[model samples]
Target: MAHFTLKQLKYFVCVVESQSIAEASRQLHISQPSISVAIKGLEDVFNQQLLVRHHAQGVSISANGRRVYERAKELLRLSNELEQDSREEDELVAGTISIGCFESAAPLYMPRLVAGFKRLCPGVSIQLHDGEQHELMHGLHRGRFDLAFLYDLELESTIVKEALNAPHKPYALLPADHHLARQPFVTLAQLAREPMILLDAVPSKSYFVDIFTQAGLSPTIAYSSPSIEMVRCMVGQGLGFSVLVTRPRTSVTYDGQQLVQLDILDDMPDSALIMAYLRNNQPTRATRLFMDYCRTVELAAVTPLAASA
Candidate 1:
C-alpha cells in the first residue's frame, strides 16, 4: 500500500499545475525545498518519475505523471467534500470558495453578492477573480474557480449553468448631446450607419458583431476597447455609439461626461446572466450554499443599475 499524506498530494498537484516548483512554492507560501521534498516523497512512494525537471525553464509532467495528476485532483476534490461534510455535521459551515466573475458584471453585482453571502455564512471566506468570458471559463476548467458568474454565451457542453436573471435586451449608448440622444428608441439600421465603439472583449465582440450580421447590417467600428467603462467614456466623448446590456446606475462616465441609453427597436436576442460550474466537479458545501443564495437573491434589485428600458 502507498502511504502518502494529502499534503504531499496537494504539493505535487500544485507543482504540476504551476509547472514549476518555485512558482508553486510562491503560490503555497512554502519554501521551494519543502515543496521539492514533498514531490520527492510522493515520487518515492509511487516509484514513478512523475516530473521532468528543467533547469530554470520549469517542469513537465511525464505520461505517468499526467494520469496521477488527474487522480490527484479528484482525490483532493473528494477530500475537500469529506472535510466539508464533517464540518456540516457540527452545524457550522466553514471554508473558502473561489469564484470567477465577468469583468463588466463584477462591479455591478459582486460587491453586493459577496457581502450578503458573507453575512449569512460568516465562517466561509471568498476569493473572487474577475475577467473576460474566456478567462473565467479557463479558470473554471483549471479548477482555480469553483464557479463563475457570466453571460450564457457559447459555453462548452461540460459546463452546467443556472440562469440568475431573465434575459436582458441590449441598449445603445450615445453621448448626451448626440443627434440620436433624444430618441426614445433606435434601430440597428440607424446605428449601423454611425461609427460604432465596440467592446472588444472576447465573446462580447463576437456577440455584438453577430447581432449586426443577423440584422443584415455591419457596424463601422471606429474604435474598440476591452474595458466597459472605456467604451462608455469613448461614447461620452462622441467618438462612437456602443451596444451594451450591463447598464450602470448613472448616465455619466468616469471623466464626468454624460451618456444616453436608448432601447433598440429591432428585435434582437436577449442576454442571460448565469452561474456556471463544471458538471464533473462537485460543489463543496460552502459553494452549494452560495449557489443556493444566488438562486434566491434578487441580484438585479440590489445592483445600482437603472430599470431595463
Candidate 2:
C-alpha cells in the first residue's frame, strides 16, 4: 500500500516545476531539508530513483519520476476539485486561481480585474503571471497557469478561448508634435514611410509587421522593444511612431512627455482580448466564477482620446 500525503506530492511537483529544490522551498515557504526528506520518502516507498540530481544546478526527473509527476499533478487537481465540491453548498468559495496575463495588457487591466474579483469572492486567492503571448501559452501547457488573459493571436487549436470583450482596433501613436500629429487620422502608407518604433513582443511583432505587409508596405523600423512602455517612451521622444491595441488612460508617457492618438485610416483586423486555457483541463469553481465576472466587466473600455479616422 502506498502511504503518502498530498503535501509530499505537492512538494515534489513544486520541485519539478521550479526545477530547483531551493526555488520550491522559497515558493512553498518550506525548508529545503523538509522537502528533501519528503522526496526521499517517496523514493524509498517506490524503491526507485526519481530524480537525477545535478550538484548546485537543479534536479531532473527520471523516467519513473516523469510518470509519477503527471499522476501527482492529476491527483493534486482532483484533490482540489474534491475540496471545492465539498464546499459547493456554502456561499463562500475558497481556493487559489493562478492566472497568466499578457505583459502589455496586465498594467491596463489586471489591477482592476483582480481587485473587483476579490470583492465578489473574498475567500479566494489570486495569483498573476504576466508575460508575452508565448510565455503565457507555455505556462498553460505546463499547468502553471489555470487561466491566461491575452490577445487572440497565433494560438494553437488546443487552447480554448472565450472572448472577454469586443474586438479592439489598433491605432497609431505619435509624439504630440510629430509631423502627422496634426492630422485626425493617418494611413499605413503615411506611417510606413516614417520611422517605426515596433512593439517587438512575440506574436505582437509578427502581427504588427503583417499589418503593413498585407497592405503591400513595410515599416522602416527605427527602434524595436519588447517592453510596451519603452516603445511608448521612444515614441514620446519623437524617435518614431507606433501602432498599439491597448490604450492607457493617460496620453502621457512615464517620462511625462505627451503623445497623440490617431485613428488608422485603413481598415484592419481588430484584436480581441481572450481568456485562454487548456481544453483538457477543467477550470476550478473559483476560476469559473472569476471568468464569469470578467465577462460582465467593461474590459474593452478605452479612453476616447483619438479622433475618428
Candidate 3:
C-alpha cells in the first residue's frame, strides 16, 4: 500500500480546482513537475486515475476524483479545526473564520454579525461569502465555508443546521396606498388576483410558489428578479406586489416610492433561518465563539429596514 501525505492531498485538490497541474503549480508556487509527481503518487495510492491529461486542453477530473476531492477538502478542514480547537482556552481566540451566507440575508445581517463577533473576540477575524441556498450548502460541504447562514429549505441530509430564534414567515409588499394596505395581514387567496413581483432566487421561488399552491391559489406573476431591490422597485411602481421573508429597514424602494408591508394571514409555510455546518466536522474554538455570538444576537433588532439607496 502507498502512503499519501497531507501535502499530496492538498496538492491534488489544488490541481482539481485550477484545472491543470501547471496552473496549480503557478498558484501554489510549486514546480509543475513536483505537482505531477504528487498527483501520480495519489493515483498510485488510490489505485484509480484522478485526472485525465490532455496535451493542449487542460485536464479534467474523473468521477472518482470528484468524490476524493470533496473528502480531501473535508479532511483538510477537520485537520485545521482540530489544530484551532486544541489551543488553550486562556489563549486569545485568533484565526480566520470563513462564513457563507444566503444572498438575501447577507445584506441584512453580515455587518452586524462580523462587528459583534469581532467586538467580543477581538483576536478573531471573519471572512464572508454570499450565495444562494444551494451554493452556500455546496461551499459548506466542500469545506470552502466553515459555517453558513441559510434558510431551512431544501437542505441536504449531510448538512446539520441550528435554527435561529425567529422563523420568518412570508409577508406582502405593496404600494403604500393600495386598497389592501390598510389590512394588517393579507391571505394568499386575497393576493392571488393581484399581479405578483416574484423574488426569483432558487428554493425561494419554489417555496413561495408552494405556499400559493398549498393555499389552492395561483398568483399572476408580473415580474421576476433574483434581486430583492428589483422586486421592491417593481412593487413600488405598482406593477405588482411581492412576497418576502426579510423586510428591509427602509420602507422606501430604490425609486424613493414608499412601500407598505403586510403580514400573510393564511396558514403559509414559514422559512426558518439557520446556522449550518457540515454534519461530520467538529467546530473549532473560533467557530464556536462566533456561533455563540450569533445565537445571542436577534437579527430583527440588529437589521432594521434601511432607506434603499
For lDDT, the strongest prediction is 2
TM-score of each: 0.92, 0.96, 0.82
Q: How well is each residue in 55-114 modelled by candidate 2, as lDDT tens digits?
A: 999999999999999899899888888887789887668888999999998988999999
Model 1 C-alpha lDDT versus the unseen true structure:
0.88
Candidates' C-alpha lDDT = 0.88, 0.90, 0.84
| Model 1 TM-score, 2 decimals | 0.92
| Tens digits of lDDT, candidate 3, 48-147 | 9999999988899999999889889877777766666666565766777889988887888888889888888888878888989888887776666889
The per-prediction CA RMSD against the true structure, in angstroms, equals 2.8, 2.1, 3.9
Q: Top model by TM-score, which number?
A: 2
> Residue 22's C-alpha lDDT in candidate 2?
96
Question: Candidate order by TM-score, highest to lowest?
Answer: 2, 1, 3
How far is 270's C-alpha from truth in model 1 (Å)? Answer: 1.8
Pairs with steric clashes in candidate 3: 248-305, 249-304, 249-305, 249-306, 250-305, 250-306
Off by over 4 Å in 1: 301-309
lDDT of 3 at 77: 71
Candidate 2 lDDT score at position 112:
95
Q: List the pairs of residues colliding in candidate 2.
A: none
